[model samples]
Target chain A: MMIDHPLPPGSTIGILGGGQLGRMTSVAASRLGLKTHIYNDTPDAPAFDVAAAATVGAYDDLDAIARFAEQVDVVTCEFENVPAAALEAAGRSACVFPPVKSFEVAQDRLTEKDFVSGLGIAVAPYAAVATLADLKGAILRVPPPALLKTRRFGYDGKGQASIHTLCEAESAWEIIGEAPAILEGMVAFEREVSVIAVRGQDGTMRFYDVVENVHRGGILDTSTVPANMAPRLAGEAQAIAGRIAEALGHVGVLTVEMFQTGGASPSLAVNEIAPRVHNSGHWTQDACLISQFENHVRAICGWPLGDVARHSDAVMTNLIGDDAGEWRQNAAEAGTALHLYGKAEARPGRKMGHITRISPKS
Target chain B: MMIDHPLPPGSTIGILGGGQLGRMTSVAASRLGLKTHIYNDTPDAPAFDVAAAATVGAYDDLDAIARFAEQVDVVTCEFENVPAAALEAAGRSACVFPPVKSFEVAQDRLTEKDFVSGLGIAVAPYAAVATLADLKGAILRVPPPALLKTRRFGYDGKGQASIHTLCEAESAWEIIGEAPAILEGMVAFEREVSVIAVRGQDGTMRFYDVVENVHRGGILDTSTVPANMAPRLAGEAQAIAGRIAEALGHVGVLTVEMFQTGGASPSLAVNEIAPRVHNSGHWTQDACLISQFENHVRAICGWPLGDVARHSDAVMTNLIGDDAGEWRQNAAEAGTALHLYGKAEARPGRKMGHITRISPKS
Candidate 1:
């Protein structure tokens, strides 16, 4: 795509979706002198408040999408799960980044796992289960204490369950609403780690320092950069991210989640990949001079990619539900960087905001 | 003073008059999830490209101002020289941060001096001059080598001339188009410094670590944090800013330019106050985790102030005109942070961008 779109400052960047990710992306894009147009199905979408233009219409609404795409210079989605049809529709006249392949792999756990495994990368022991009987057999092979996850549209503990015993088998399958699934032998890992790497349109790749991620109930809880990984391991993780990005011809930041086991544990298995920018990279906003959000904007804008150097050793903690309600306390705490998502309701288990702290790394 | 216009994330921040200050402010507001509407008289206004909605209309166009403000939730201006009527027009219905009082002071140097004086602060010995005779008389009463500056709408070595010798009077008067002016005794100063402070709507004020500033050709060239002042002196400087903010009831970041002079060097004396956010605070974006831009957003939105604590001793260097053309060298320089304002041309003397490098104080 020869994007000579003449996207100067004040131009609107039409974004598909209005979650916190989109909300934050809009924030970064706006900082670069670009206006943002958020298109999402929900009227109450969080990003609506901060955007220049917004279309509260379903992704499938042709008229709405056409008008939405017409309002901005280029279009990008906050989440990778934007339907293929919706992307094709908005991508007609607007330049969409991360390409359609991002959603293709991102939308399905099976395809994503295969894509990772196909790259000669490490992933949890996994098998595709297209039917109930196939799932049972795969479980029999993989054994109990395996994860049965829907192949499509699963996140934050939704559309998935652990098969701890046979009594929970049918119910676990039913909990996922009988969707197509991927069964995997769960890896007992010491810690979850994620590497967020950016690939510019010109084929240059840069990675933020590795972030050791902490999650609770499947949702990201915290991420500390300059993650306690050996330099070689961090380099290896970055290389894995780069390979995936280059393989997908990916533009913008790609975050790959992995499980580290071994030594004291079993070690090193790929968990999943988020083709777009990830929450795990949020610490970049405060810890690195150029944040992941800003780098994503720069990469997508056809500008020279920025340095991803970390400014300080940092820790990022997500403020979930009532945790976000403690912003006053968090804000007053010295050296802590508080970022509130501006969400009205602090619903239980919902991500409301996060805090990043920079401390001496002695 | 009530802001009935409660714009959330997706709305536009209508900026009246786009300049470098507007451009930076637009960048800051966007990072907090607000899209911008940069309305400047010229098409090439620095802030326009980064905004979503822009109107190219003369400052006096009330209809255009109304239309622009109607489309945005809040209206903020970069230049205070905007005709009071023009500002009043834009701020008629929309929320305007810092309001007209701040703009009024910035337009006239004499009034600004008096305003600061009324706040029990120090300003240089000053006198107003509506004519050349008044200018001559004011100068005789003040120091032999005093500065004669246009009372309204002067900046950056423009709209005013240096008066070194008595013979330069007619030319100085003519060069400024014989505008209403002010004459002040030039204070012998050890250093030029500024305090960038933000006052929240709730009456709290937050000041960044006082910055030591260096200017070349009347343009800000470098700013270093921990301005190396005695801790008490730094506290005194911040107190001055707080008093000014409280007096103006200012609701955004205000950059107070001051002269540090006296005894071998007298310490600091107030020079001028910028009603809007200032360039001197640019280092806050990278050195301080919460940034001046975010603070501006918080102050204007009636949100709580953020931590302005510096993580490291920080240095900011301006990329003026062709200076910004050295993007490659700056980008390649390790540990030196680069920031490009996305300006297309690097015209001579034009401020294009800046760089910041934060090092710990030994």
Candidate 2:
């Protein structure tokens, strides 16, 4: 789809969520002389501190969203969980990038898997589980050594349970609170990698170098570029990401996480797609000509994507919970770029900040 | 001098004199989880768009400045022309970097030259001119082929006139509004260069690579890194900047602009000193490991200075007047990073923004 016109410097961009991603996106927008108005349910949203304007209200509040949409030149979201009704209301009055279809596909695990599989992409075998009976039947096909995940509102490994055996299917259904769910057969993956890419309003697309991701207790702990994988595997990962962006008609940054199964060839499996900036791509902030945040803003504004080549090798480590207590030492280290989220609390498993260390590639 | 404590994340950074410098600086501060309160004389200040809080008042408003300082953990100014009384008032309530003494020396052309010369640094030969008679007498000592410039409030070739011969002394005095001025004998320089360096509260200092500057009608047109200069001359410039920062006990970024005189060795002559972040250092935002703005924030907060190394060769060109109209073309250019100040009007000679293009160093 072609954008009507490119946003000028002084236009205001309306962001649908006020988290760290929104906060960093606001900073990038300001650098381009664009203002941002952030909307989030929490009163103490971190992005509010840097945004030109902000509203503390629920995404489902149509009146509030309508007012925000009317005031901004374009609307985009930081997270995929933005309510479909809110996007519809905003879309009626403003340009909402990534469209509702992409969000709809990614909102449910089963729909996302079906969409990718329909595109001839390889996905772990999955079955929809709406009730205990559905779970009982799904176990017969998907089998044990699988994951039963809630269909909606799941992140950072929450709202999911591992099914080690058929006997545990009932407990897994109970663990997910009897919510609509999906059962996916386990794949013996050697490692996880993700591709962060952006598509302009005019259909131009670009991708950053694939990054290898490491998680600790269901939360992202580290992301390193130069994933050290077979060139063919990396190329396949990027191709999958590009095809997904094109399929969704995406007009902003999107990330596709994949499983690299252990084998002589190391084939890749489609995991899940995020229709917004991803944590795994944070290293680009220090190593590339343009960061993912800037490219997102550029894409939504109908501008050309910036050069995404990395001139340095970088490792990004997330600071979770009390990890921020070592900020002093991190700040003292040379070549360390420390970025804090400005969150008031550092509860266990909470993402407080991140640090990226870079060195020029030889 | 040692700071009692380093300002932690979420601390407020009070910036005086809101402009493009303040806007960019606030963005950098936000990236570190710091909030900024901007003070400027106009409500339409570009920096106000991104600042967390803002005060519209003159620098002479001691009450407002005092209140701003009381609310922030540290105070810094974007320009040296900030009233001494305002800084004195703010310093009473908060930590002000690059202490007022440095401003006193750099605010006036005569005092700046004398201070640098006192450190055994070579400066342009000069004589003070307070009146027409003073100008006539200064001609005898400074000789012809000189420049008569105001000792204060002079920037970008404003408030200055060239004295080609002794007969033009009366006209030169009239041209300068009979203000206190300095007559300096011109040096036959092959090129101009500037050194951007920072000094922390604990007295640690570091310098970025030297940049060669080109002027169009006395305004900065372009700054290129890896200045094609003799290594001895570059080293001398860095040394001079370091010594000046040490002598003034500066606690933030400062720039020393010098003339690379034509000769077999091409020795340097100190032309001027700025006690705050300089426009010539803008390239550092993209070329160096850490930007000058971030370093300034780090210095004032008593944090360790970041590495000041460049991994790429960069050329920064200022977009003045209607040059911003070509922003789309600039944004589409590979390797070019575009920045636009949210200025509503692009009057003649006004700096709308700048673009920096970089290439990986071989």
- Candidate with top lDDT is 2
Provide the lDDT at A143 for model 2: 80
Question: Which one wins on DockQ?
Answer: 2
Error of 2 at B176 (Å): 1.5
- What would the TM-scores of all predictions be? 0.86, 0.98
Q: For candidate 2, lDDT tens digit of each residue in A252-276?
A: 9999999998677688898899999
Tens digits of per-residue lDDT for model 1 on B28-91? Answer: 6654445677888988776664555678998888898888888877777776677888777777
Q: Candidate 1 lDDT, tens digit per residue, A119-203?
A: 9999998888877888878887888899999998888888888998756778888888888998888887878899999988788
TM-score of chain A of 2: 0.98
Q: Which regions of candidate 2 deviate over 4 angstroms? A: none
Considering summed lDDT, which 10 consecutive residues are worst modelled in model 1 chain A?
A1-10
True contacts kept of 1: 0.13
How well does candidate 1 match the true structure in TM-score terms? 0.86
